[model samples]
Target: MEASELVQRFVSRMAEGQPIHTASRLLDELREDLIKIGRRSAFFESQGLPLQEAWVGIKFGEIMTFDTIYLAAKAQMGFDVVLLKDNVSVQFDITEATDRNVDRAEEYRSGPEMIVEDSGEIARQESLFEKNVGNRLKRKSSDNLIVYVNTGWLPEEKFIEDALIRWHLSFKKKFNSAYLLIRGSVVQLAPELQKFSNSRSRENGPKS
Candidate 1:
């Protein structure tokens, strides 16, 4: 079938009550596009340019989603993912009465722990709200074409570790140049992704 015909059918299937089946097929058809996007993004990184700068693409998800996709795309393009956290002021003071850079330690300790707590609480609320809204919208949209994007260049591992340490007083797992996701269409692409590069050229297209 033509790409236009396939898209229409997929959209129609979504409008009807066949989301599961339709979305699965639509993903099959778009897998090549996704992989191409991933590969091109990787190539751009080699030149120290933004992935989006090197290719034609669309932003499908919110900030968080985009962040995850960027990492995955980077990996697909053969690059390491680095996580960095800034504005983390650690102060210590070293006096005759203290050992090992006590002044610097004190400086780091002086930052707004309470402010972190307050902001964390708010973030938790917002995250919960976003999840609920996302799930509900997922259910409502028969097409099931939800996209999220996070453009902030915060280091993923550091961000998680710092957030956990600050809010829960604990450390989380470390990540390096990898994509991690909890939900959305991208997850579905994993198994069949190896063929994603040639997906658009498949004769039968994506199987229903």
Candidate 2:
């Protein structure tokens, strides 16, 4: 609860005991998870498989947050948060899960932000969902996607699963998963998207 008491109470009042995660919190959680994932072998691994102790360590370098340099990053890494780590650095394209299928570009052109406004105007640009799904999911640097909805979203149920399926088939990319943070909830969206093999496309894929 590094955030002020008012922020905590504001979240609690909106979603009960469940705290709504902001962009800053989401970035921190991902950073911690990447480190802990390296230590999974210390406990349980995937099913019977365990992470090897020799391959357990992962070193992270300086982190690039989308706080002030988001516009600058658009020309380089192009992701909201660029986490530099050993081996290959991980890139994240963070966006606000707009209440509609279309993106509110004006509100979020500067990358994902702490938007206090409720859903209203939204226009389509190059939405993350459209860029990386179905046959288009095989790009080299699509980047891990994170979409979060603000606390102001009402229960209109705009971003439903069925619509995602249609959008999934139209696009093409090998993005494994898209993480969605709705108010105080977190969902791993589109894990069942078709396979993205090295050579062939749309064979079979699994969400982790």
Candidate 3:
């Protein structure tokens, strides 16, 4: 199916209360389609560059992350309803996912970050997840953490190692999954996430 069609179908399934796994699979397909589209953009096509080269364009961002997670929650978790309070901005976006039957609500805060060059900057991202992990663990109702990192602009090494480490050690268990916005695609940090990272590390090699 086309990317747009798949996206609509995903939203429809969420509204109709389909399985979260099913919705997530559709989104996984959607991400691939989007990457294909990015490959065809004029800049990449004209230069005969790989589709991977076009990932830093405007189409890739954290908004894509929210759509995947929110839809999955609506279908998978008991969150039958969702509310969007505002447009996504540089600061952050707020969303509320609620299961009225259980009187439970999860407040999600999501935004995009450019992984910093200095390792010290890792603390900034970790601090955000750390605060939310505490709340998520204590709550039976809602999971309050959602973070999306845009790695297209990162140096390949930082993209693979530092980014994966932060997600694996700190955010993985607490958030179910954290989204990584890379190469103009949003991916759940699944098992394949590590495999993909390792391959890229090999391809990029050590810095001169």
Candidate 4:
């Protein structure tokens, strides 16, 4: 199939159906893009998230359609995906905060030259979200921010909650809400931490 057809397939399946459970099918359809992924595939592989799954379009297909939260894909202007339910629609940006500072997902699709100053600095000077959030925050969180916090980038349970709490609190401008995806469990952390909000406060710092 042509490259354009692959994208069309992705749109047709994900725009109206349950793509949450259909990740593999989308991966297969879009697998050719893996060859395009090329050099950066190793970095993603080391992170334990294969190029097929980590690819931008494929990631959108997965974890997007499992619940009542309907995701209608949008253009670059705003709201990467819009939530539709009943008679209301909410804006959401499905973004990633990976271990590496670069937005490799966009690089893969747009074919830009990537720069890596120091691999040793990965997640050292700042948390995953902090490094990448600066650009995304230009909108200042008008749209709901749904982040895929790659495991290599962050940590488990409480540690992640703490990082998110610290990251969210540090910024005067913040997301309408922030949701973190770690190890298959989805945790909402901003505006509120669902269960942890009461225990957390701006003064609290994340564990190093």
Candidate 5:
């Protein structure tokens, strides 16, 4: 099925107040399948294949994350959604997943840095952030700058916190708009800085 059709069916079943137990299971299966299809389709399109070949190559697991988030937002809050490489931004409404939803908060927090580790991922995320921010300033940027950081793997909280404070102070001195959405423990931001700094140190090699 086409992505749109699949989304519609999923939403329709959901709106009917179907039992979460059964519906969620089905949704999970369908979402995984659809995303795999979508990813294959995207790959084929990139290869300049004909539309039919692209469609046939699509797998749902590849796009399941985007679709599930979109559907959740649509069903709960009626928000119009747009998908980017690392995050999904909602334009018309933001009620579905507020800052308080730990899951959404965690996603906004960690999703960006996860993208930053790889050059390709960084370029993709940067393009999307730029598109979302447009003419806006960076720090006062509000919800426009969410990224994932893989906080689960980092070290102690204090170490990360100190790093974030130092980074924030340095960045703020240069540009007040240097804010970022850090994921993982609330302390992951500092560790991310340390991670980057450590990587740079290794690249620069030993002091004289």
Candidate 6:
């Protein structure tokens, strides 16, 4: 099928039903694009994430539909999918979502903690999130989004909640929003994260 037709199908399916579920399908459709960008086996290995498994790509379920839709559209349009194992962001030209000039997005996460308990893995991932925030923020995006994907073992709700709290506490002000892909589901970080960001700006008041 032509890329345009595929993009159209995506838009149609999305408009007809639950966006949360639609987003997962959209990601699946673009699986090839994900793998294409992830072809850099050497790069993933350099980062210490098992290159063999890295190309498997991330997954998302049905937590935050709108966020998923936004990401799905971008990914479908062909944003560069970089395997910055500890971080994921997207860079793209604002062009039509056709096959020819398409690309994907970037997602970040710490290398999986195979031996550690869930708490330890969560804490370690959180630390990686905190440690990488500054560097990820440095890459300016007109879209102003900070996106991350958790590659750890099955992420539970508690992990999501805790990680979001940390995100609000840490990088809330620097980016417009944070999107997380956990267990094959895409979700926006807490709304309060953005609210807190605005609050901080007000408290600090404009820098003179």
The clash numbers for all candidates, in the given order, read 30, 10, 0, 0, 29, 17
For model 5, residues 1-208, the per-residue Cα lDDT tens digits are 7655555565555434333244445545554656666632232122221221111111111222223222233345443222222444323211111122343223223222222356675455444433332223223322221222222323233433444555554444443122222221211121133221122111110011
For residues 74-135, could you state the per-residue lDDT of candidate 2 as single tens digits? 33546544433233444556543332343222322222323323444221212333443322
Worst 10 residues of 5 by lDDT: 199-208
Task: Pull out the clashing pairs in model 2.
Answer: 97-148, 135-172, 136-172, 136-173, 137-172, 137-173, 137-174, 138-173, 138-174, 195-204
Give the per-residue Cα lDDT of candidate 6 at 70: 29
TM-score of 6: 0.36
Better of 3 and 4 by lDDT: 4
Per-candidate local distance difference test: 0.25, 0.31, 0.33, 0.43, 0.31, 0.35
RMSD after CA superposition, every candidate: 21.9, 17.7, 15.3, 10.4, 15.1, 14.4
Which has the greatest TM-score? Answer: 4
Please give, for residues 25-69, the per-residue lDDT of candidate 6 as tens digits: 453554443345543322322332221121212122122212222
| Better-scoring candidate (TM-score), 2 or 4 | 4
Q: Which residue segments of model 1 deviate by more than 4 Å?
A: 19-22, 30-147, 150-156, 160-208
Best by lDDT: 4
Candidate 4 weakest ten by summed lDDT: 199-208
Report how far off residue 14 is in candidate 6 (Å).
Answer: 11
Please give, for residues 1-208, the per-residue lDDT of candidate 4 as tens digits.
Answer: 4444445555555555343345444544455454464432433232322222223323332333323233353443455554444545556666654444454443333211223235455334245445554344444455466665443422333434455576666442466676654433455656766532221111111111
> Total backbone clashes of model 1?
30
Ranked candidates, highest lDDT first:
4, 6, 3, 2, 5, 1
